[model samples]
Target: MADLIPPTGRVHWVGVGRATGSGLGLVCDEAATVLWGRTVARAEARLEELGLAGGAEPRALAPGALARELVPGDVVVAMLPAAGHPALAEVALAGEAHLVCPGYAAPGLSPHARRAAERGSVLLTEVGLAPGVDHLFAHDLVGAARAALGDRPAVAHFASHHGSGKDRPDAFRHHFDRAPHEALTALLTPARVIAEGLPRRVARPWEEVRRLTVGGETFEAHPAGDSLPFVTTYGLPATWRLESFARGTLRPSGWNAAWKPVLAELAEADAAGVAALAERLAAVHPAHDADRDRVVMSVRLGVHTDDGTDWAGEWSLDTVGDARESATARLVSVPLACAVLEVAAGRVPPGLHQATDDPEAVRRWLTFLTARGIVATFRGDGAV
Candidate 1:
């Protein structure tokens, strides 16, 4: 029996599920010590697989009890769903433990963030692949553009595209790295994005698709979630001609034609209907443990000055997973894992925040990723 001990200044992984646990397990291998808190058989199986079953402490405890046991200086990595975040964040705040997650911060995260700030604990969210890495690249590019022009550019356009699946197409033409239910649910979720300097609700996101070519392969980019908040977060000048700013999910070519109608139906479906749809989709796109997944990300920033000078910059990352983990999981988890370690080491500032825009921090994080065999490159004139 593992006691719900207070902050020993160690890492605590609060859940062990199929999609997220493998990445968390990789972090466990890197950390000096970790408390593996989970309720599933997969938890034990993963630890044994990682050769840490004998070393890492595994506690099959509930989240509430586990929260009470955390203490100041502790790093709590929540590997659960977004629905469970606010409650767990409240506990981490009370325990004064730094909280990090690969998921987006729920709307209810504000209060928890405020309390965490008062406690001097950092609550960092959106540290995964698409939102996380995309945020970093966007911020860096915007900053660089402003610096080059010696002022905020008169016009700024920002866009990001990222996605993952099998290197080759299958029956469904795509596969999900996460639970099919989660993927299906997200397909219909409405988001507010900025387009031509106006806020718009994108109910059927796949309808707004942009195409791109990476490594000689074509992929379709569709608006995933809102991009307005990030435009502000990146500190792009509102006074500038902010023509367009959007973050989108990337998929193989022809994905838009295939998924558009399917998402339209899901948007009008009830809970039961959604469940049924999820089941059908899952059956067609069941994950294969032996399959190697890939992650492709591209972020672009374009700015124009009245002086007739124009500047455009872009950052791209394309990686494939090895035997240890899926490319999707590794890309999503490693940045988060690095963030957790940095928080525990007293390097990260204390506060509720989204992905960081600090240049040095971004550089350090990217360097870490490059060392892990991730092929990342920045190409732009006078770009940071």
Candidate 2:
């Protein structure tokens, strides 16, 4: 490990998108923060909307503008699209600053991570919602299962789902930078899962949709991304025989039926046609102020030994947005905010980190999240 650069407590938060919620307030309360938006005025407006006016400096996001202001040991919280992260990583590296993002670690960031490790700076990713909170839940469950089952043969299943609220206009919810159609198109990519002790690639994930129940509510679930790597990431013992493993998205029941037409159109449409379709869909289903969102995430693991000892456990989070903040924004940003605070305090080591697998850190983060009103419950059956 490289020597860590002592934090200066100055933070540059880029992007004021939907995921930017009260979490910014958490960062501002702890650091000398600057909120960056497409324009200074837009950033200011968001601060005011977040009731954070005068809480932090506001700036326009001009090319190279943020890099010019960074100093060694400062933190850069990237709330932008995944494509924009590598460039920001470069900026952070050039300034010898630490970087944090709530999205998955892009392959482009690996080189930056190596560089950051050498420079004594940190590059943290996947600390939000599905990738973030879900990871914590998975790690906790795995730790428990390992303690209880040892090297016993076991079967495991994991799923995290975000469903629509009662007031949502349509099945599709636009939470990230991508347009609805574009986001849907990206889902066409194949998903990899370990099933029946064999790795398999799913070319059409939506077609593999299965019904799942979390907290007594049924949802339509399907694989989201490649899950093979997480077997090691989650610290599952290789000696244990595996039955099934997957990481996927969850939607309201009947979601497949509701999205059939749109999926058909997306399957056939070219780029321009997809853009047009997105526009039509947006116009028809414009998100309203009254619109509320809900998120439901569940991670479960089950193990059995030849002696007939059975152990099973599950961790779940189900939250609905209020008039003040959307559930998506709260769940995503709050955990990210906690991560930022952790980095600022020099708790996270330099190099690439994907939400800590350390048991103590996981416990602290869950406590912080629960204190802030985002809570995940756990249930266990049989064994230690």
Candidate 3:
């Protein structure tokens, strides 16, 4: 990935659902001047809000509707729920339009990817923040490590730490305060691990807990799928034991010490007990109840030389007003805008493409994000 890919054409959005703080909506709303959204009402409102009109027309997200009129050069952004993305990708592929998403590249999208390549179109996914910028930063780190040390890194760990908004009218509430054990309940869901050439997997979110301190602030971080995918994605050699993941969450401090009980309950499989525990946790990490809340995350990639020497890398971003417009939304959606351009120009050679797999696209796209107001940084113990 060239840092990241740039926009290659006029954008056409596929889903028209309510654009809350969703990445899809942020992309559609922000690129309103250049892109067309499928939902007529939402598109009109978004257009009116952005002070732009009809660069795109509102229509159903149906491919037949799209295929009959939509052809090459159109960009289809799939911001629908996780289950719907695969279908949407297929729709766009059949119509000869490009595809983009902030979501993971699930097994389902594989077929559409194959078809898109056959059709000579781009099928871009995971272009937003965590999955988007996160992968780009990791690839750069991986590439740099190779340049710095003769031996590729063996054991590597990746982690993302951040907090979501408290339950408001619509926002999902993030826990800020809970017993230390309570926090352990998430042992399986968040941190998942994959080692190079290791047939087995290890998941004990609680056991992987490590206290994280940044910016003079301290918090506990339980590994979240930080190291699972990278080893395979990078195809490291047997000597490499790569485990990439993210675990930085937004909280004042002492959050880790408080959530232990929740973890214990999770182990007990107490359904009602879990819900009650969740509510209690929210009470402690209550939303600021104002529109001024924020999300701060730092994704770090730690590396060890094949000789067992050590190094570190990081991309730390603090996004404010997340309740109003979350980092999650922007991270997922903005990449769609770039994918639109790539497909419009026919640069994406289909098949299955990973953002980190293409150095050029990764660099180009990351550069574009800086202009769009995304804060990015490269820090390492040693220079590339």
Per-candidate RMSD vs. true structure?
4.2, 2.4, 6.0
Q: Write the per-residue lDDT of candidate 3 for residues 288-339, one digit (tens) a residue.
A: 4363434556666676766768777766665554434545455555565555
| Model 1: per-residue Cα lDDT over 99-206, one tens digit each | 888787758676776666666778888888866887888878877887777574477777888888787766456876666778776777776777877778888776
TM-score attained by model 2: 0.93
| lDDT (Cα, 0-100) at 81 in candidate 1 | 74
Q: For model 2, state the Cα shift of residue 137 in Å.
A: 0.4
TM-score for each predicted model, relative to the true structure: 0.89, 0.93, 0.74
Model 1 score (lDDT): 0.73
User: After aligning candidate 2 to the native by TM-score, how far in Å is the CA of 211 from where it should be?
Assistant: 1.0
lDDT of 1 at 304: 84
Clashing pairs in 1: 7-71
lDDT of 2 by residue, 204-245 (tens): 788889999888877888887788888888988766667788
Candidate 3 residues lying further than 4 Å off, grouped into runs, are 1-10, 16-39, 49-55, 60-64, 152-191, 194-204, 235-252, 260-262, 270-289, 304-310, 322-324, 382-384
Q: Residue 272 in candidate 3 has what lDDT?
A: 72
Which candidate has the highest lDDT of all? 2
